[model samples]
Target chain A: MTVSLDLSDVTAHYGNTKVLEDLSLHVAEGELVSLLGASGCGKTTTLRLVAGFLEPTSGRIKLGETDLTRLPAHSRDIGLVFQTYALFPHLSVRDNVAFGLKQRGEGRAARQRKADEMIERVGLAGFADRFQANLSGGQRQRVALARALVIEPRLLMFDEPLSNLDAKLRVDMRVEIRRLQQINGTTALYVTHDQEEAFSISDRVAIMNAGRIMQLDTPEVLYSRPANLFVADFVGFENVIPMRAVAEAGDAVRAEIEGGGMIDLPKQHYTVPAQEFVLASRPEGLLVDTADRTDGLPAKLGLRTYLGRAYQYQCDTTAGPVKANGPLGTPREEGEIVTLIPQPEQCCLLPREAK
Target chain B: MQRRAHPALIAFAVLTFLFLIGPLVIIVGAALSDTSYLTFPPQGLTLHWFQNVFEISAFKRTMITSFQLAVGGTALSMAIGIPAAYAMARYRIELPRFLGNVFVLPILVPEIVLGFSLMKSVAVGSGVPIMGALLLGHALLVLPYCVRVVGASLNSFDFSIEEAAVSLGCPRWKAFFTVVLPNVKPGIIAGFILAFITSLNDVSISIFLTGPGVSTLPIQLLAHMEQFFDPTIASVSVLLMFVTVAVMAIVERTLGLTFLTK
Candidate 1:
């Protein structure tokens, strides 16, 4: 059965200091969600609260119709895999897998059968008898996974499970973990700091900052239509220009270019913010010119970097020195006058107050 | 033109070794003295003291008492220590720094002082018997070691395994037993054994708490030495040395002595 987790206004604290503040989330059944953030954003804290390791200071954690907030970790039927892959060093892979079953009073034969199946499922078919201490980092992680899945938990939480592996191994393990979750149809809440990992595997990525979720959306929406300036900036919106309304219509605005040029703003636009706004455009959306043209703004080219598949150029613009990418073999020279044009469809405007 | 080892470092090492083992070496040499005296560099070689030590009924009885105390103390300390260590390591308990200080204070205080205080508090006021008193004292003394060793192991241990167990449908206690406890076993065993040894060789506390009939081996040895300068004492010391060597071997095999040294 696919389990769904509902966290409503979950508040957690360490004595007087609050770690999580009025956190609310709804993870649909069979959905793979990631809590993405830097350190101290309460990402790990959220996972711990759901796993019953830390009781919420206030709020309800429910799995389907079952209230799990009051229950201890063991009674919650939630599985957790930590980043360090805390395998019992003394136990063999098979025994490690069998541990939970034995504790629940499953028969010896039944436990062994279940453990063997889990071991095979995690690709440790031949390493059943080997102690965890002797296994490689990837092998130990798989053993930990087998041990967790053996109990058939209703909900699974991964505490940055792939963060311990090397870069190449992390990518490989992320695929394996996602594949396993998909095959099992498990409800998963994965916490991680790597934005790319969150974008790759999560059905919904919750971007957290300062104990609150800044934005929660699918990878596409988070990248394309961020809720605020922070989310836009964090998602790599490169050039943010200040735009003042040229007319009293409010929507009709003009961005004064650094050199000598002005870009017109369309009034009564549905997407543009009405308040005093700053315009943001991604580097891929901005076009650079090498020679001076009548319609293009003048740019003092500083450096041009050949990036194999594309050209990365740094130019002095009205918004200060800005960086932008062009085609692979663009004939752009250093110390050349250039004009920059922004694709209106790709530009995002944020409230002027957004820092 | 050749570089020399640091004379001060070498001299300090030699002095430390001698300070620690000088008495044991003396007792070993005295065991072989043909003349009935606790003197090193014996005039003649003999095993008469070994024969005498074996024949002493008090020695046999006291050895049993000390053995029981050490074993019982280790069990009691481990029961409370392992979980306490885990709690300290895994959770952010209120005033953890204060609790940590309290746990280690027992080790810092003089053994004689702790022994007497415990006897007054638990034995005299609480009406605990001599055996109970000895067991209580020894357990308290060893509690700090158990916490330090087991707690240190848990601090360095990867907690992901416990999380894995929890995620697998195992309850918190079961997960701890299956995942956390098993991983910290080596540290627990090392701590337990060290606590046992400490209780075994304890003389300062045992001296004050020992009743008329119940006495630990170390107290018995001290009593025996006061009355006689016999070879039997030397033989008993040799046996004690052997036990210490065995303990060192076990510590080396289980949790490396390097950590203990630190």
Candidate 2:
């Protein structure tokens, strides 16, 4: 059965070193949410807390109507697939999948039948009698997936499940996991550090930094409109220029950059009121023109690279080295001066904070 | 690049193997001698001494006693050592290095000193029964082997498997029995055999603890040799050697002999 998981004001620490600070997140029923961040950003810690492996120093965790904050991992009715695909080496693939059913007191005949069905579903039907050590990495991953899903847990969690696979198999398993989760409509929480993996599999991505959630939004929204400097920088915003707000108009504020350039930002994007703000834009959001235009900032092109489908150029502007991607045409030579224009709606405004 | 060993090195290796196994060959040969006196390169082959081992009541009683002590000591050591090993491997035990040293201290002490100490403390001071004192000493002497073997297996084990079990609706204790125990079974079996043989072959400790009527097979054999230098003792020694080899073969067939080396 599908269930919503909610964690409010959760704080955790490992002996006196604080790992998570007042982290709160909610996953809707049958929704897949990914906690995405770099190493030591508390993404794995958050997943462990939700899985009942680590108790929060202060917070309440609930799955639907059940209070799971004080429950032990066995009573939480949750399933976790480990990064190493921790299948029991002594047990066969079928036995590994039936482990949970056996624990639930299922009859031997019934458990075997169910395990066979799950093994077939995961494409390991012929390999059921094989031990984990005999299977390849991709096959081991499927066994882990089957083991976790056979129990029909209330909430399913994965800790970098695809990280151990080869590059091609990683993509295949990612799509397979996403398809299974959708078909089952199971509430799932996935943790990963790769941005592309998180974006492709997750319905919503929660960007975490320094043990706190920086932004929680859909993949498209998070890419287009990050909340602050950290989220923008983490989500591939290569150009961040400090600006001072000079004028406020209807639903828009005009800010002046350090190098005598001005841009208008929507007022609703600002989370805090400040005279100093930061303007952030993705590398693809800036348009490059060869002709010297009146409405564009002048910059000198430094390095140009051909990225198969597009030409990416590094431009030295007043805001520092800005990266932009354009159509594949004539290669731009080094030291060529070009006019770069930031797309109006693609820019985000944030209150400047100490880095 | 690989090169063949020198002829001198091969000769040295052959000599070393003979040096190690030559005494056992002499003892087996003497056990088959037809004459009453023990002699290697026997004049004639006979199984009379082997049958004589069964006729002696003291031999039969001491053999049973040794078997009981080995079984009891091995079981006790495993019951205590496996959990201790698991705890030390999984959790952060306080002063782990110091505690590990404490568990292995018995092995480092000289067997004669350990025997004397147990004689004074357990036999004289505590006034435990002779059999009890011998069992306790054997268990203590073999505990280090159990801990070391089982601990090595646990060190390489991935603990996340147990956590995976607990997350799948199995309680922690059940998870341990069903998951952890099965995976480390080879280590347990190896440790048991090592401990059992150690108990069976012990002489110094059993000498200090044996009362008037209770004696281990090794101690009884020592006492018998002081009175009679016959081929019967060699026959008993050959039988004990056979039992040890049989146990090792069973271990090899079931769990592979690599566990012992590990």
Candidate 3:
């Protein structure tokens, strides 16, 4: 049976440099949670901490009510798949899959039987006796997945598991890993720098920056409604319009852009602070309006490029440069005076962060 | 496109190989000679010297002593060197450069000079027995190669495998045996064979260390040569070469000797 994992206020360091600062996360039973971030953002470090390679300086880590912070890696009973597919080079595929069983003092016949079953499940029926050296990269990935799953570990972890494969094989292996993890119903934590890889396979994705989770949500919510400026920018929000709330009108609030223009937004659509805030929008959310429009944020079109289904424009505004998309039928020319409007469905309002 | 070997390069390689093996060929030829003295071209073919090599009481006695020294020295060096090499390569020890340089210091000193120093310190000054002295000296002599070869392998080893083992329910200590040791098997075999051969063929160190009624085979053979310069010495040399070649062949067949170059 699988179990949930919880880390309460975990803080970790590499010597004097603090990599994680009182961070916490939880993965529910049989659920997949991905730690998605750039390098050095502590995603891999978080996985290592859960795997018992690094003990938190001050925190309580629990796996299904069993405290794991003080336990050694071997006693933690977690399965980890490395980026390099760290299979034992000297052992056969079946033997490598059975290594955990062997270490747990299982008889040879029992280990061999279970290992062979796992090998066949990963679609490596004929490769039971073959060593990792002879296997292809994709085949080796399957072997790694089988080995980690064979022990029925409480939690399974993957550190950039598909980074070594080619583009095609990476997608295939990603599906295989997700399917295998689901079929076994094991709680798992995945760490990856690839956003698409994370979003496609994870039940929830935690976007990380500077060792902290900026936002934790499902792919749909994260794609449409980013919680803050950092996550909005990460999820492809190109323009951040700084604004100040001026007044409230019935069920809507009136806010003025920092440089010019004012607009009313439904109060239910945004939660802005009392003073300053940000209007974060994807390129498609901010539309290039007709020249001479009255209720549009002021801008001067600098360049225009065709984007297959739409035309993207570079607009110079009073606050900063902005990239926005306009309809393909009406392409704006360079140096044309234009106005930009925000579409509420593709845009979000976030509170200005305290530095 | 097909590639062709340059004529001059081919000739150079042939000349270099012949230069290396010419002396060995002559020695083997002389080993089967029917002669009173060591000679390259034999007057006739005979196996008398091979039979004579078995009859010498000193040869039999010294052979056993030499065998003991080789096996004991190799075992002692490997037992110490494997862990020492692993620690140096894997750990963030203080002054890593200094520790590496210190382990390799014995090899830098001339063999005869080191042997003389050890003889004075371990044999005469300390009153240790001659066999004990020889065993200790031989172990010291081969320790450097064992550390060096195994250390090279450990340096390039993907230590993530060891971590994987630990994460897979194997204890840290057992991870070394089940994962690290098996992965670095080539280096261990290379180190062991190098130590064994060096200890067996060593003469300079044995000269200063051997005492009354206790001498290594090479030292004993040298004393025999002074009295009778014969084909029997050539036969003994051939036998030593055979053993070395056989050991190397087994290594080549098993894990391959490519790691030797590495």
- Compute DockQ for each candidate against the true complex: 0.59, 0.80, 0.75
Instruction: Kindly indicate the candidate among 2 and 3 with the higher TM-score.
Output: 2
Give the TM-scores of the predictions, in the order they appear. Answer: 0.88, 0.93, 0.92
> Please, what are the lDDT tens digits per residue for candidate 2 over residues A196-278?
99999899999998899999999998988888888889887878877787886668777677777655556565432478877
Q: Estimate, for each residue in B1-262, the C-alpha lDDT of model 3 and write its tens digit.
A: 9999999999999999999999999988888899899998777899998888889988889989988999999899989999999998887454357898777987899999999999989999999988889889999999998999999889989888999899999989999998999889889888988889889999989999998999888888899899999988888888889988998898889868887777
Task: Supply the TM-score for candidate 1.
Answer: 0.88
Model 3 chain B scores worst on lDDT over the 10 consecutive residues at B89-98
RMSD of each: 3.5, 2.8, 2.8
Ordered by lDDT, highest first, the candidates read 3, 2, 1
lDDT of each: 0.81, 0.88, 0.89
For candidate 3, the docking band is medium
Cα lDDT tens digits, model 1, B11-55, are 999999999988877878888899877777876999888887768
lDDT of 1 by residue, A203-275 (tens): 9999999889999999988987777777877888877666544444344455454333565555544245754
* Greater-lDDT candidate between 2 and 3: 3
Off by over 4 Å in 1: A103-105, A248-261, A265-270, A290-299, A327-330, A333-337, A344-346, B1-23, B92-94, B116-127, B253-256
lDDT by residue (tens digit), candidate 3, A87-134: 999999999999999988999999999999999999999999999989
- What TM value does model 3 have? 0.92
